[model samples]
Target: MARVLFVVFGGLAYLIFFATFLYLIAFVGDLPGVPRTVDHGPAGDRITAFIVDLGLIGLFGLQHTIMARQGFKRGWTAIVPKPVERSVYVLFASIALLILFAFWRPIPQPVWAVENPLAVSVIWGLFALGWLIVLSSTFLINHFELFGLKQVYQNLRGAAPSPPRFRQPFFYRLVRHPLYAGFIIAFWATPEMTLGHLLFSVGMTIYILIAIPYEERDLVGALGDDYASYRGRVGMLFPRLRRASPSTPPLEARDS
Candidate 1:
């Protein structure tokens, strides 16, 4: 019964996360049919809207960073079952995103609007590509484990957790964080750049920048030499221009 419940939680969390992620694409793109978007939402005082928007972004960053820390996970797992810890994390993240979507106050002041047909098409193409990279990058690692399904399955079978192993399959070989790279692209690759949109992009990009060091530090502590070596060789979010030296080991890194 406990195992079944964990499975249910994990599955539901994954479903919600998937839906939230899709909604995020439309939300950021300001696509037609969405109730609200970064640049189209409830109207309010410019100052108040900016404050509210910044608060929302800060809330999101804090939740993501604090929760992802190893110290927090150790304490959090004490309350949330080990099998469902990752699932719960997924659920919380989805909820935070939904909250942002719901209450966001748009600062619709125009920053840049691309009227060029060809350039607009190109930017949109990059936007789509960014989301594709993010989605695909998950599978490059262990998508199930990254999202939490694997843990529940292991628990259901009464199997011990699998040992951690480093892998730099495909995109990981190109950049240390292809997932984050994709996000940066998606956030900025819009034909219309409003103040609200700029805020969202800059805020998220800053979070990613701040997050990489902490994430890398944790990865180094967990995976030790392999990650340190990989970090030494690969750029954080961009492809390294310099070729790897002959003495360098094959890239070996993984993200949770």
Candidate 2:
């Protein structure tokens, strides 16, 4: 059946996405055996490297941002089956990431390297924790859905996927975009900050910043007043110390 085939395809795409994500962790951290890391490639022309690296990142960002918009989704699903649209998105994203990791030109110059053992350990720990937060946050929301597995599975089962809901559970309460926060923490908490690492961090950080407004716009449109109210009460990428006034109405109820 087409439905079963779609589910299988989605599952395969998820496997690739998961592997690529793990490889990204190792790539950023410069773990063993990864051919290219944030700071582990041979020296090359600075200008050429800069342009190439930026192009790679820009391509990824362009694909990611464009595909995420509601307008694009509306048009895309007109041609592609709605159930597999997400899988296609995931596949392309994974390919983009793979291209970045494969051809990235590392600058290899140290911007900062901690000499203190204690500080080094702490920073490394924070890097790991940042990744943990990113992974955990997906589950706190819907890991399967976020990764495209749930959509195809539900379709195969003849069930309509549920609408997006406004939620502020766990890290969501701390920041409207905890995944981005986690990425920021992971990118910057490195004990050794190479020029290449810095480029990747700064570039991605810029993308994250640019992405928030657009993403929030989409969220406001999808979730309406509920998201607008939550936005007022929560920080975009950091936690608020104090809760909103008790007079503020509670967020609209929906399944978490």
Candidate 3:
């Protein structure tokens, strides 16, 4: 049946996307076997390599931003089944990442490299923790839903998807965008900072900063005053040392 096919396709897309994401961690960390890293690649003209690398990153950022916008989703769902749209987006994003990994040019020069073994070990531990935070946050906020598996499964069962609800789980209570925070920590926690790694970090951090306002605007539109209140009290990407006022309602009960 068409519904069954959608579920299967969505599941496959999610698997590929998740695998690619795991591979990205290895690629960035220069674990082993990869052809390119922040400092591992064929030598070439620096200017040309920089331009091409930026182009690839820009392409990925553009696709991610555009596809996530409300206007684009509205238009896209008009053509494609609503349940499968997220899967399609995931597929496209995975392909974009694959292209980036395949063609990325590395600037082999080191900006900074920590020589102390203890410090190196600490940084590596932080890097792993950052990735752990990212993965855990997804589950706290409905990993299956985020990955499109929940949507297609519900559709196949002939059930309408539930409305989006506002939630602030453990890490979310600390920071408004803990996932992005995790990414920031992961990208910068390296014991060795090569020019290519710096480029990738700077580019992604810029994208995160730019993307947050748009994402917040959409959240406000969906969650209204609740999100506004939360925004006023919570730090955008960092945790506030002060406790919230007693007058503010508990986050769990405040679903739109």
Candidate 4:
């Protein structure tokens, strides 16, 4: 019963997010106080924007699907994590508030308009260009997950000690945390970037900070001294061109 409830609620929540995303695509430029003269373009540009939004939805769906495959229980358990139960409520509340604002907020039509068609085109073009880069990065990162290719080491949950297997090449060659990097890029390039979205960004950043440390702690436990050496070489979220050591094995030879 709990699993069933979770699936219903989670699906509804996903729909609400997609609905708001589409709403933003249609109305962002029309919002009151929004500068009209920023940029405008051909119908093709509008279609491109729709494609980007759909791609984002797909990317998020993929992430959730992967987690579900990893033994995610159904219903409320699907929506709510048993660990940190309070966080589930907060997450749902936040999503609900964002949805309400997306639909109910009275965004007045901008009095100051983009009178020039050329200028409007330019604004849209710039947004589209940035979005393209963001989407490309996200798609590349997700491809790795879809393939189920493991790298040198994996981070165990809850700061437990574990060593991820060593990897020599491929996508893992460039960055330690490609998924997080993709997320950061997407958030920055989102067309609906607003004060509320900035707040969401901060919230996500905090979660990353808190969650990563514990996850690292677990890796340390599993990998022991070897993970410590890798930690010294690889960065948390950034790709470094040069590091002191390239491929150091975790102290513990066995995979956790």
Candidate 5:
């Protein structure tokens, strides 16, 4: 019952978030580069800042909605079961309100500026490619839905099964957490090349670092020795060239 309610609410939230994003992009059109310190011009400058900041907030909200939906559909027994944590969601909410307030008033808004069009283009291209990777991985994972008749049967018994095997062939082979990697890539790809934007990204990166370790520990506990072995084979967030097999024997066999 709780799961059902969560999914319903999450779906609605996601729809609202997307609606805001589309409305802004359609109304505001392409964003223009602005100074990093302050937007000291006319009313249009303030409008632009409001639009862009709102768009970012919408994006974050959408992320939260998806994560919540995933948690409801799957099991939330693990810590940080979704893409973003509860604290992170609250943080985004607070930031969104602050930004909206700032934009509403006649505050000194240092607009994020993007210089070097080529670099911006390259970063955007990479971001698009990263999203493709993410989409492909999602598809391969059966839209993150559970798989197999056995798994479905188990779910009916109120037992959530392990993550599907498709994860390995698609994104898991490259990194332990491909979704996070994709997010990092996309965030970095933004054309806001100002110091403030860079600092914000850095702060977010630090949050990711703290969140990843907590997530990993939860996975390790839930997945047990097998997850530990997988961790040994794969890097936490980055891709690395690995040999086919490790020299160590299986942990299960050793236990037996």
Candidate 6:
């Protein structure tokens, strides 16, 4: 019964996180339906809005970075069941994102607005491609595990989760972090760039840059030589001029 209840909790958490992720796409893209986007939102004092936006980004960075640390997980799991630890992390991260989305204030003053029809179309194409890469990269590893569903399912089945292994499938072969690369592309490729949008992109880019070292440190500690060797050969977020053999392993990224 406890195991079953955990599965229920995990399922709910997964649903919430998935919904938040989808909404995030819309929010970042400034799509039509979302109530508040990076560029479209309630007006406020520019200075105040800037501070608030900065704080929101900081909050997310803290939550994302701190919770993902191995030290945090080592202590955190003493209270949270091992099976649901990842799920709880996902839940908390989703909540942080939701809070950011809810309180975001847009400074819609134009930074750059592309007038050329062809350029605009190209930028939009890159935006879509970025999102596609992000989503597909999740599957290249284990999406269920990355999102926490697989751990809970294993718990329900009274089975142990698989150990981490090294990998660089397809997009990963080109870049060590295709997911982050995708986000960078999506954020910067917009045809209409506003102060708010620029801030969002810049903030996220800084966070990604800062986060990568710590994440890589963790990966190296956990994966040792295999990952180190892989890192040596591949670009952190871009394709190397040289190539590696087509063999990839299953090294989990936790969720970069």
lDDT winner? 1
Write one digit per residue (lDDT tens) for candidate 4, span 1-256. 5444444444444455445444343333334533221122222333444453344333333333333332333345556544322223333433543443333222222323454677766656654554454345444544322222111111112232222444323333455554555445444343344433443344445545555666556556655666567667667777676755535543432322
RMSD to native, candidate 3: 2.0
lDDT of 4 at 84: 25
Candidate 2: where are CA atoms >4 Å away?
252-256
> For every model shown, what is its TM-score relative to the native structure?
0.96, 0.96, 0.95, 0.38, 0.53, 0.94
Candidate 1 C-alpha lDDT tens digits along 105-191: 999999999999999999999999999999999999889999999999999999998876777888988898999999999999999
Q: Candidate 5: where is the Cα deviation over 4 Å?
A: 1-7, 14-120, 135-167, 190-192, 242-245, 249-256
Candidate 6 residues 1-256, lDDT tens each?
Answer: 9899889999999999989989988999899987889988889999999999999999999999999999999999999999999999999999999999999999989999999999999999999999999999999977999989999999999998888877777887778999999999998999999999899999999999999999999999988888897787789997888665556454455434
lDDT of each: 0.92, 0.90, 0.88, 0.42, 0.48, 0.91
> What TM-score number comes out for model 3?
0.95
Q: In order, how many clashes per candidate?
A: 0, 0, 0, 30, 2, 3
| Model 3 regions more than 4 Å off | 245-256
Give the residue spans of candidate 6 off by over 4 A: 243-256
Report the lDDT tens digits of candidate 2 across residue range 1-256.
Answer: 9999999999999999999999999988988887778777766888888888999899889989999999999999999999999999999999999999988899877899898999999999999999999999898888999889999999999999989987777889778999889988998898889888899999999999998999999999988989999998889997889889897787754544
Estimate, for each residue in 42-73, the C-alpha lDDT of model 5 and write its tens digit.
Answer: 24554565555446545544544444343433
lDDT of 3 at 141: 85
TM-score of candidate 4 versus the correct structure, residues matched by position: 0.38
Could you give me the TM-score of model 2 versus the true structure? 0.96
What are the RMSDs of all candidates, in order? 2.1, 1.5, 2.0, 12.2, 9.0, 3.7
